[model samples]
Target: MVLAAASHALSYFQAVVIGLLQGVTELFPISSLGHSVVIPKLLGWDSLAKAQSQSESFYLAFLVALHVGTAIALLVYFRKEWYGIIGGFFTSIAKRRIETPDERLAWLLVVATIPAGITGLLLEHELRTVFAKPLAAAVFLMVNGLMLLAGDRYRRRAEVRELVRTHASTESETEVGRRLDTLDFKESVAVGVAQIGALFAGISRSGITMIAGLARGLDHEDAARFSFLLATPIIFGAGLIKLPDLFGHLGNGVRGQSLVGAIAAAVAAYVAVRFLMSFFETRTLWPFGIYCLAFGGLCTLLFI
Candidate 1:
């Protein structure tokens, strides 16, 4: 009873914090959702959890709604692009514009979504059980941070190599511009493969895929667009699977509280998305890397 009360006390704060984290961290190279899990786990969530025993898994429901909150934020923020992408799907073939990059961008989302969907389905139970361990989550958080650093380093290397190549070739500006859209199906697939690692480690789905996209020579903005687009399907799929559980637990005790938390999360996440878009435009990934490093190290110390 004492432990449950403490856990309940933590949930209110965790809601706002995690919502904000979800909003900002989702797009930032450091995984916000990953950090959400890792941070709480580090803070002795698991220990409290074990003391309580046979917990109703209402937290799982809370998490589902939290993602849904962020998903709504993304849809609201990107409504225009989504509208165009959806419209372009049926209209483009009729208009006979030979599969524009927008179309390919739409297709690339599918390419990237597939692997994670399969992987998540295969590993969901294992993840839920194992992710309860804060120390493991902390280690993964460190791994996730290194992955982001490595990605940024690799991207800079590629950009430098491309610049060198361009200087060597005396390439026309037009030709250089042409290279951005040039990533093929194979490269997109490779990025999808990069996404699988995100499931195990708390790497942002956006970060790893964006790295793969950068490696494939997509400019940062385009890579970001691809990353966000890839998220829509994965988010929707996960929500569907988790939604069934939400209702069974509804009104069972924590439902009202969880719903309240969901709304709080949604509102906070909306504001977060508003600011994060602008922030990413001007920022580098280094800050998020630093945050993950510090947070992960703290978690490791606490949990280990």
Candidate 2:
């Protein structure tokens, strides 16, 4: 049976807005999930918000489309890196030993992806059912802000800055995959484990993963690269699993809207990733942290 009320047909405009929001926020170290939940409520789109709270709602199916678009954008943006990584993965499997920097980085990504992949498989539904509400998401968004702030603060510690400065001066021109390959298996696992925190409605996968990478001594550029690389598979897999929903009864009335949304999401995501790669080259996470705090605080107050 269709879970979403028949009256709640998703409009094209809303689809575009939500899709753009998903694309940008998914990469910006701000919680895309949080924004998706909170924005509709703030706009008084009660039907859309109500649909999201339903387990088998059409909104959930729509989200699958958005995720697929975002994933595609990420894949395209990092095509060169992914090409090397995939080739390296297969070559290592054939050789039965990792030899190259690409091979090591590919395996490192697999190791780091395990914890979040497993956790998401088990807990994603339950967590969304329990805490996907606007009020709950707003609260968690504030917490996410604090996490980002803490990560930035940690990066600014005197010793940490000195260490990064020395490391950067020597390895400034190194390839990102090679730089990421320097992380040991244990550090990769730690970074992967940090992704679990993003299972919460307002916690950002990119934000927390980047924080973990920074904690492990990666510069902002490499940290962002790693976070995006790790997220590509996770996001794509999650969406692919639910892709059927978009073609089933759940998508009956919103197929056109979903298509438009997906395209908008793809465009927005490509632009966002391109901008962020440049932004992080010389910038820190302080701006994002502050934005999250302000936005989350305002939303929390409004919802309450």
Judged by lDDT, which candidate is best?
2
Model 2: pairs clashing at backbone N, Cα or C within 3 Å: none
Q: Show the colliding residue pairs in model 1.
A: none
Q: Candidate 1, residues 161-261: lDDT per residue as tens digits? A: 57435532223322221143355667778888888777754667778887777666554555666777777678767876788766663324445555555
**Which runs of model 1 end up more than 4 angstroms from their true locations?**
1-14, 42-56, 92-98, 158-181
Q: For each candidate, C-alpha RMSD in Å? A: 4.8, 2.7
Tens digits of per-residue lDDT, candidate 2, 1-304, equal: 2433442468889999999999999999999999888999999988887777677888898999999999999999999999999999999999999999899989999999999999999999999988889999999999999999999778767766555554423244432212566788998999999999998989999999999988777878889999999999999999999999998988877878888999999999999999999888877788889988999999999989
Question: Would you estimate the TM-scores of all the predictions?
Answer: 0.80, 0.93
- Model 1, residue 295: C-alpha shift (Å): 2.0
TM-score of 2: 0.93
Candidate 2 yields a Cα-based lDDT of: 0.88
Best by TM-score: 2
